[model samples]
Target: MSKRSESFLRSRELAVAFKASIPVMMGYSVLGFSFGLLAVSQGLTWQWPVLMSLLIYAGALQFLAVGMLRAKAGLFDLFVAAIFVNIRQAFYGLSLLRPFRKTGSLKPYLIFALTDETYALMTTRKIDPRLKRRWVLFYLAALNQSYWVGGTVAGVLFGSTVHFDTRGIDFALTALFVVLAMEQYKAKRKLLPFLLGAGASLIAMVSVPADRMLITAIVLALLGMFALRKRIEDV
Candidate 1:
């Protein structure tokens, strides 16, 4: 294909992909709204989620990072802590290289949107070049950001009036993780990493406090992946 033809095709593909991701977009909005509400209750302002949606994009990482802030954690401490929670993204990126290599400028957005949910949707594809790869990434980035932004706005408005307990809300995140894990398990080979990760995370949760469990889980998952890299490739 000519360069111009490829560009046009990519754009069209992205548009179609965006349209197809409507359900996930709606889910993002609802989840983001819940996150925003939680943020406000923790004494944060709208700018926080706005900035977080634009920059961090990783929902679980941001959620964990905010707790450090709430505790007045030192900058260095926050960095050290977040590094553990977010190290999984590096693995996601490794698996995503083929899809993201064609994305050019959209590569950063694709990387940013590599949340558990987004990864679940994109990686299930058995074939590729299905959409202009760049466009596929753009659609994912835009859809996720829209959800996060919409949720933040809703949370800011509703936080004051709602009085229900939020303890159950934490489970929303857990459920998302479970769904993502289940999706990753379609392949038997993939099950090894998923189980490895789950086992590591469970061990960490047992040994660490809620605030630091993310770091522990990340460390253990990374070590587990490294040790089992050969087996992980068999799938």
Candidate 2:
């Protein structure tokens, strides 16, 4: 690449970051808004969503945690459930370790903020330099977090009057997983995880209770991960 082109890319990384962040910003806001509405409806205080957004920051996981808490689950139960539900994120981060090595001071934030959407965007995006990559990563995190915080604030303010259908809100998590799975398939052309998840779900649906479902899925997912590690590395 030419020196001028490289310089321009570095300078314009913010624009790339913003453009890449738009889709995630939209999805997270709506989903986060829905969670906020549900939280308030379940008698949670306004700060609940804020704390969730700040502390957990995993969009789908936080929403699931809220649901479990609303159901009167204990802290230990919630923690264990979260371990199973979010173990996928550990794989997501592992997949990005090489791509994220050059993020410098922003590496921690990039790792922490790597939701499925952000991971998809980062993996697909083509940038020239390490600086540009970090810029993109930082912007994705900032924008997504903004959406979550903003949506939660809006929900807290207007949840009482916004009598909309929430039946479809749960699909946000499902949709994200589908998108991530598709991304993985696109990258590796693998069907193992998809089949594994389906098989596990079928077994869990028949044999596992509601609370145990995630646990079973986690075990199955880990086994699948180890089984496919060689395929993944080869790919």
Candidate 3:
């Protein structure tokens, strides 16, 4: 192809990626804003939120880090917690192996930027094959992170100045998860995985302390899914 044609195609891919990422943009902005506001409210400075959003970029883990930081948690503890919280991303990465194989130097950044929303968009949306797949994926990941970081910065600025009730702001993250889960269910039309997940969570909640419930639930769900993998795949 001619240079002009290549440039135009690249731009088209970027535009498509940005458009597809708009839903995540909306969700991340609100959720990141909530993280920033909550972090500051809990006595963390604006810098922590901005830095974590830019570097860590894991929504749930970042929120958890706020309390860990406040409690003066050690590096080993933080590392363990981060692993447990983001273990699901390891599973997310498995699904994207083929798509990311040709990403070259972009592979590391792509992996780093694979938040739940980005993964959902990539796996669920049908992209035009004519577009450069790697570039499209790269743009989608980059654009989503930019939205999150921008929201975190805005939230910190807002929280630093204003002082209203931030009581229910954290619900934004949970709401986003619900929407994503609903979208996944609609797309896959599968019930077994959802049922197993809910059952594991309930079991974990009853068996474990509140502080350990999330990790326990995730472990239980993964084990259940693995044990029933043959049935799930058949369905």
Candidate 4:
């Protein structure tokens, strides 16, 4: 393609990516805002939210980081907690190894920007097949990150002025998970998978330290899935 043609195609790809990422735009904006609000409420600088979202881009972990910052968590402690929390991304990365490998310069950014929402959209392959897959992935990652960064900036700017009477704000995260689970079950209509995950989590909660339970649960669940892979496929 000529220069003009290439530019047009790139724009088109970005437009499609923006449309596809609308749901995530809405979600990340709210989630990012909440994080910013929480951080500023704890007397953290606005720069912290912007920097965290720009560099780290892990929503849930950033929320936890707020508490860690308040408590002055040590480097080793932060490292361990991050490993335990984000270990599941290993599975996500492994699954998308092929697609990401083909993305050339975008490969690094795609890996870095593979938030849960971006992973879901990319793996689902909902974008037009005619669009270059690598470009599509690139735009999606870029646009999603932009949305989050914007949201964090907004929250930090306005968080101090707007006080929310959010007494039960903590439950909102749980509600979002329940909604995601229901959406998955609705899409696939499979109960056993969620049940197995829940079982593993419950076992870990009872057997492991609170700080360690999440990773243990995920490990146990992955093992259970591997053992039952054959039967689960029968579904």
Candidate 5:
């Protein structure tokens, strides 16, 4: 193709990817801003929130890390917590193996950037046939992260200057998850997964301390899904 045609195709791919990522941008901007504001409020330097958002990019874990940082947690403790908090990403990666196989040099960055919102957008949104899939994926991941990082920076700047009550701000993350879950249910119309997850969460909440509840629920849900794999497949 001519240079003009190639440029046009690239722009089209980026436009489509940006449009698809708009929802995540809305969600991440608010959550990431909350994280940054919370991190700074907890006595962390402005650099910590910006660095974590740029490098770690794990929303929930970054929230958890604020306390860990305040407590001066050991590296090993952070490592373990990170693993427990992000174990779900392993499952997300499994589902994307085929689509990512041909991503070439971009594979590593794509894998690193596969946040929950990114995964949802990638799996649920259909790609434009005229645009290259790999480029679209790359643009989506990049754009989402940019929104997060931008929000983090904005929060850090604002928090450093203005003091206000941040109570209940963390609910933004939970609200984002609920929205994503609803979107997934709408797309798949799969009640079994939701039922199993709710059952696991209820059991874990009753049996474990709040600190341990999330991991317990995740483990139980994984086991429940595995046990019911055949049934799930049929459904």
Candidate 6:
């Protein structure tokens, strides 16, 4: 293809990816801003949120980081926090191994950018036949990160000026999750995963502190899926 035509096609593919990633843009912007707000409220500089979103980009973990940073958490605390907050990502990568095979040199970054929102969008959103799958996936991940970074920077720039109650700001994370869960359910119509997660969480909470609950729940949920592998795969 001619250079002009190649550029045009690439732009079109990027547009489609951006369009598909709109929901994530909305979710991440708000949540990332909230993270920025919370991080600054903890007496850290606005740079904290901007850096966190740009580098870390994981919503829940960033939220957790705010508290951890405030409390002066040690290396072990940080390590455990990361594992608990990101454990479910293990399953996400496993499921995407086949779909992401074609992403080639971009595969490493794609996997690294596999936030929960991005994962849901890639797994559930239909791709246009004419657009290259690898490019679309790459752009979706890139655009989502951009939105988060924009939001965080905006928050950091504006967080100091605003001085109102952030008493319930953390709820925004839960709300974002509810939205993602609804989208996934609509896409797959499967309840087994949700049921397993809830069951394992309930069981885990009974045995561990709230901080350790998610990691334990993920472990139990994985084991449960393994025991019911046939049923899970068939579904």
Tens digits of per-residue lDDT for model 2, 2-36:
99988777567767787778887787778778778
Give stretches of model 3 more than 4 Å off.
1-3, 171-235
Model 5: weakest 10-residue lDDT segment is 209-218
Q: How close is every model to the real structure, measured as TM-score?
A: 0.68, 0.71, 0.75, 0.76, 0.76, 0.75
Cα RMSD of all models vs. native, in order, equals 5.1, 5.5, 4.0, 3.9, 4.1, 4.2
Better of 3 and 5 by TM-score: 5
User: Can you write out model 6's per-residue Cα lDDT over 163-196, one digit (the tens) per residue?
Assistant: 8776777677777679988999899887898899
Candidate 5 is scored at a TM of: 0.76
Compared with the true structure, all predictions reach lDDT values of 0.73, 0.76, 0.87, 0.82, 0.87, 0.83
lDDT against true structure, model 6: 0.83
Query: How high a TM-score does candidate 6 get?
Result: 0.75
Per-structure clash totals for the candidates: 1, 0, 0, 0, 0, 0
Error of 3 at 96 (Å): 1.3
Predicted structure 1, TM vs. truth: 0.68
Worst 10 residues of 4 by lDDT: 165-174
Better of 4 and 5 by lDDT: 5
Which runs of model 1 end up more than 4 angstroms from their true locations?
1-15, 125-131, 160-168, 174-235
lDDT of 1: 0.73
Tell me which residue pairs clash in candidate 2. none
- What is candidate 3's local distance difference test score? 0.87
Give lDDT: candidate 2, residue 177.
76
User: 50-71, model 3: which lDDT tens digit per residue?
Assistant: 9999988998888877766767
Error of 5 at 232 (Å): 13
